[model samples]
Target: MKPTEEDNKIINNRRDFIKTTAIAAAAFMIVPRHVLGRGFVAPSDRLSIAGIGVGGKGKSDIAMFAKSGRADISFLCDVDTRRAAESVKAFPKAKYYKDWREMLDKEHKNFDAVSVSTPDHNHAVQCLGAMQLGKHVFVQKPMAHDIYEARIMTQAAEKYKVVTQMGNQGASNDGTRILKEWYEAGLIGDVHTVHAWTDRPVWPQGISWSINKANVPNELDWDLWLGTAPYKEYVNKLVPFNWRGWWDYGTGALGDMGCHLLEAPFSVLNLKYAKDVQCSVGSVYVDEFQRGYFPESCPPSSHVTLTFPKTEKTNGDIAVHWMDGGIQPVRPAELGDKEIFGDGGSGTLFTGTKGKMMCDTYGLNPRLIPLSKNENLNVTQKYKRVIDGADGHYKQWVDACIAGYGKQELSSPFEIAGPLTEALLIANLAIRGYDLKIDELGEDVYPGRSAKLLWDNDSMRITNFDEVNQFVKREYREGWKSITL
Candidate 1:
C-alpha cells in the first residue's frame, strides 16, 4: 500500500538488513580453501597444530614444533592446570581445555595436526580419534598400551592417508642409520642376538596401589586425567609421576624405555614381530619372611627374551634380550675395564660373529666395541641427516604434514614404529605374564612360568598360553572405548 515517507523509510531499512544478512551467510558458506582443511592448505602458509597433553614431554614436543619456524601452535589442552600453566604461558593466544575430547570436538577444523604426548594408554584413542577426523598425528613412544592398539594405530595411519610419526625421536638420529649402514657393510655381521638394558622404574615399582585414598588436587580433573584408565581412588604422588608403575595407568618400565633403547636394534636388524617370547622377573622381597608380588605394580626388575624369525638380512633366527630395573648383560670384552658400557647408565649392545657394536640411549654415540676399531674404521655415510639431528625429529614431522601425507619421508612412520612398538609390548606381555599368580586348591600357583609363550603373529596371540593373551588387547573402561578408523 502507498504510505507516508516515515513508513517507506522503515520498509527500506528492513529490506537492507535482510539483504546484508543473506550476503554474509553466503560468504561464510563459501569457506576459504585454506580453512577447508589441511588437505587444501596453501603450501606457503604455516601449518596449524593442536597439542593434547601439553605438560611434561608434551610441552617440549610442542615447543620444538613451534621452533621449527614453519608451524603454529594454535591450541593447547591438558587435564592438570598446574602442569599446563607453562604451556598456557607459552601460547597465550591459543585456547585451552581440560579434556581433549571436548577440545577436538569443538575445534577439530582449526588445526591441521595433533601432537599426543599423553601416557601410553591414551595414545591409541587420541591418535585414532584424530586420524578419524583426517588429522595428522605424532604420538609419544611405546606407541600404545597394548599389542592390539599398536596394530590398530599402524593400520589407521595408512588407512586415513594422514602423515604420522611416533615420538621416538631417536628414530631420526644418525646412530640408527649409521648402525644400519655398518650392519649392511657386514662389519657387525648378521646380528644373532641383541641386549638392550635400562635402569628405569626409577619411580616406585613392585608394590600395590595404596588402599588409602588421598585428596584429589583442585588444579586437576581426576576423572578426565584418568581418561581410558579404570576408575580408582586418587593416591598422593600418583599423578604426574608414579602412575608409571601401575598397570591401569602405565605399561611399566618396558613402555617407558623400550622405545628408546630398542629402536636401533629394530632399525639395524630389520626385525619384526617376535615368533616367541619368554621372561623371568625378579621378585621384590619387601619383607624377609615373604617375597611380595604386586600384580597391579610392575616388577622392580625383569629380564625378557624374545626370539624373532630371521628377516632377509639375518642368517638365522635372532634372540633379543630386554633388561630393566638396573639389570644389564655382562660387559663386552671389547670394552675396557674403565671404558663405560653403552654410555654407562643405559646402552644397546649388538653381538656379532665378527665383532660387537654398542651405543647409548636413543642410539646416540654409536661405536664399534673394540675402541680402536671405533677410532680407526671409516664408513661412507649413506643416509640423509636431519637438519638439527635429534631436534630435527619434530621439524621433520611438521614439514611432512605441511607437504601432505605420502609426499615426504619421516623417521618413525607407523610402518616402522608399529612393528617396533609391537615387539616392545610383546616383550612386556612376558613381563606382565611373569606377574601371574593363581590360587589353585587353596595354594598359590604360577602359570606363566610353565613354558615359552609361542606367538602366532597373524593371530596376535600366545598360542600356548591362554592367560597371557588377555593382555594382548586390554579391555578399556566403559565409555572410554577406542576410536574406530
Candidate 2:
C-alpha cells in the first residue's frame, strides 16, 4: 500500500530536521566508539590535528576541518609547497612543512590525530607514524597500495589502541544501511552472485611504459612525487590526475573506484575472503612505448571474475564479476522488471535465490525488484538519514575529536574496509597477466606461479607461478618509506 500523504509529511519533516548545534555537540561527547560508528569524541578537551598532502582532495579535507569549528589545525605538510601554500588560508594559525616525516618529528606529541591524504603508497607510513605516538588516524582509501601494507595498518591500529577510520564515507549513507537491512531481512535470499562495475573513463586509460621521454615540469618535484615508486624520468602525461592508470603509483580504475562500488557487498555479505580468482585483460589503451602519456604502463581496461568457494559452514558458492570500460552484464532473464542502473561511475547488482536488489556505487539510493510485495512475506525496515552538515568529510572527523568522546569510529572503518580494498587491489594484480590464488581465511595468496598460468579449480592456487609474492610489498625511496609492521 502507498504511504498516506500525512504519513509522508512526517517522514519528510524528520528527514529534513536540522541537528541543532547544541544537540550535535552533546551527541559526540556522550557517544562511544563501538556504538557510534559515524561519530567520535577525543580523550582530550581540545584536539590538535595535522594534515599531510594538501592538494586536490586534500584541499577539500583541510577546508572541512577548518569549518568544523572544533579542532586546532597545528600543521600542514605537502611535497608541493605551492599547493600547500594555497591551503594555508584555510588554517591561518597552522604551520606548514614540506616533509611529512620532518613534520612528525618536529611536531611530536603536538597533535592528537593525523589526516593522511597522500597517494596509496604513503598512507601507511604517515598514518602509522601518527598512531605510534598514540595519535588517532583518518587515512584515505585503497588503505594501502598492497596486501602486506593493508595487514600492517590493520594490526597497527589494533596495537596502538587508537581511533582509526578509513575514508570510504559511502559506508555511512542511509541507502547503504538500507541495503544491509534489506539483506538481513532476507529481501534477497542467499545471495550467490554479484556484478559491480565502474565507468571511470578518466584520461590516460592505460599506457605501458613505452614513451618518448619528455622534460619534467619545473614546478613539480617529480622525484618527491614518485617517492618509493620505481625511478623514472618525468612525463607530464602521467602526472596530476592520470596516475590512476599507472602501475607504479595508482591501482588503475578498479582501485580508484572499487572501495565505493564494493562497499555494499563487503559489508553485507561478510565476503571476508575469496578464492579461485581469474582476470581477463583487454588491449592496452595505447602502444606501450608512448611514455609520459595518459597510461604509463597500465592496461586501459579489463574484467576480473572472482569466484568464492563454498566453505564447510556454507552450502553454496558465490561469484563476483567486475566490469570496466563500458562493459556490462546481460540482465538475468528470470527477473520480471528492468532495473534502474545509475548513469554514474559505479554500481552493484545483488542476485539472490528469490529476488534481486540494486544500488548505485556511492550508496546514494537503492531499488528493489517487484516493486509491490506482500507484507506477510516481506520484512519491516526503518532508516534514519544523517542530516546535511558534514558537507566536508574532515568536518565530520574534527567535530568528533573536540567532543572528547570515542572518536575512532570512521565513516569507513579500516577493519571492514581493508579486506574490501585488498580484494580490488588483488583483482588489479591479476590483470597484470598472472593467475593468482588467495587463501581468504588465511589472509594470504599462493607465492609461486607462472605469469600466464590458468586458474585451477580445486586449489585456486596457480600451479606454476609466484604471483602473490610479487606484490608482497614495494621498495621505498631513500627518504620516502612505508611503515612496516
Candidate 3:
C-alpha cells in the first residue's frame, strides 16, 4: 500500500512535534496541581482521593470521603497486608501499595487529595509529601507526634495553598459553635480555666518495652510500619492497636483525645500556643517494692496544665488542665452526684467568671452548669452549620479543595489544628519531662519532676528545662528526614 504525499507530510510533522515536546510532556506529567487549581477542576465535579494507612481508622476515613459521593478512592496504601484487606476489597479497582512512598512516587497524578491515617510519627512526612505534589490533605489528629511536625504541617498547608483538615470530627459539630456563641455573648464570662480529661491508653502504658523480639507477622511489613521511628522488634500486641502508649509511635492519651476535648476551648477562647506547662503522673508497679518508670512508654496516668496567654476573647491568661489515664478533676458541686460526668467516658469543663460549662468527648453533649440552664439557653445563631454536622467534615474538605484554596471555611484546617496539636504536645513535654531521671549519688533523682517548664512558643522550646526540648523536635531514625518547608 502506498500513502499519498499529503498524508506522508502530515505524519512526519507529527513525529517531529512529538520529538520536540517529549521532554516537556514528561515534566508536565508531574506538574504541580495547584498551578491547575480552580479553573482546572470544576468545583461541582467529583474528586479522586489517595489514602495512606488504609486500615482501622484509615479505612473508615476513606469510607466517609467516598460516602460523600463527590470523592472516589483512587489508591490505598498500608504496611500491614491484613489491615489493608478490607479497603482493597472496598475499592478493588484502586491501586494498592505496601509502601506509601512508592504509591505517591508512581501515582501522585492519579488522585486529587490524600487522606493520612498513619501512626502519629509518620503523619507529617506522608502529609507533607502529598502537599508537595499539591494535593489537598486530611490528616488524623493529633496532627503530629511532635510540636515541630505540627508547626511544619500548618505552614505547609498554607505555603502549598492546598485545602487541609485534621480528622477531629468535633470541629464540624454544632457544640463548638454554640459554645463559641455563648462565650462571645458573655454567658460564661471570661473563661479563666479549663479542665479536659479522657480515659485512654486503653492499651498498656507505664511499662517497659518488650526486650524480647517477636517474629514479624506474615501480613505486616515491620520496617515500613516503623517508618521514621527507630528500629525495634515487632512485638506481638503492638499492631492493629496498642502503639498509642509508646512515645516513639503515639502521643499518649492527650494526643488521642486532647484535640477532641480541648478544641472547644481553643475555638471558644481563640487560644494558640501555651505559655508554660507542668504536670504530675501516676507511677507503675514493676514489683511489690519497686516503682516502674519506663521512659519509652507514656505514664499510666497524668495531669498536665498548660497556660496560654490572653487572646482577644479573654481578659487574662487561660489555664488548661489535661487529665488522662482515667484521672479526672473533682466533680463540680453544680453537677448532681448521680449525674454522669461528661457522658462518663470523657469530658471537659470550662470555668468562667460568671459560671461553668462542660461537654463530653467530640464536644458532644454540651451542658451549662446545673444542666437545667441548657434547657432555656438562648444565643443568636452565629456560625453557619455544616450541612450535616460531623459527617459533613469530609465533604466540606472535598468541596473546598474543588473550590480552590481560601474559597471556603474549613472546620479543622491544619492552620487551626496545628496550634491545638502544639498545645497538647507542649503539655506532653511536661508530661514526658516527669519521666526524665538523673543519677544523684547512688540513688536515682528526678529533675523534671514538679517543674513549671516555661515555653518559648516562638522557638518551640522549653526555656526553663532544656531536657524536654529534645522532644519538641524528635530525632528521626536513620535514612529518614523530617518534613520541612
Best by lDDT: 3
TM-score of 1: 0.90
Of candidates 3 and 2, the better by TM-score? 3
Superposed on all Cα atoms, the candidates' RMSDs to the truth, in angstroms, are: 6.3, 14.9, 6.3
* Clash tally, candidates in order: 0, 23, 0
Candidate 3 lDDT by residue in tens digits, 278-349: 999999887899888899999999999999999999999999999988898999999898988997968889
Off by over 4 Å in 2: 1-44, 210-212, 285-296, 309-315, 332-339, 370-396, 399-408, 434-464, 478-482
**What local lDDT score does residue 136 receive in model 2, on the 0 to 100 scale?**
78
Kindly indicate the candidate among 1 and 2 with the higher TM-score.
1
Off by over 4 Å in 1: 1-43
Better of 2 and 3 by lDDT: 3
Query: Candidate 1 overall Cα lDDT vs. reference?
Result: 0.88
What are the per-residue Cα lDDT tens digits for candidate 2 across 1-485?
99999999998777666546668888867766678565454455456888988887777776666566566778988887666767887778888887787888988767888888888766777888887887878877788887667777877877887767677767767667677778878776878888988776575655545554678766567776777787877665665677767677777778777787888777667775566566665554234674222323456556777776564322487788888876777664544555456444568888888788878877666767554442345446664444442253465566555543354345665677777776776676577633234588878453322233333423323444555446646677676656765
- Once model 1 is optimally superposed onto the true structure by TM-score, how far is the C-alpha of residue 410 displaced, in angstroms? 0.7
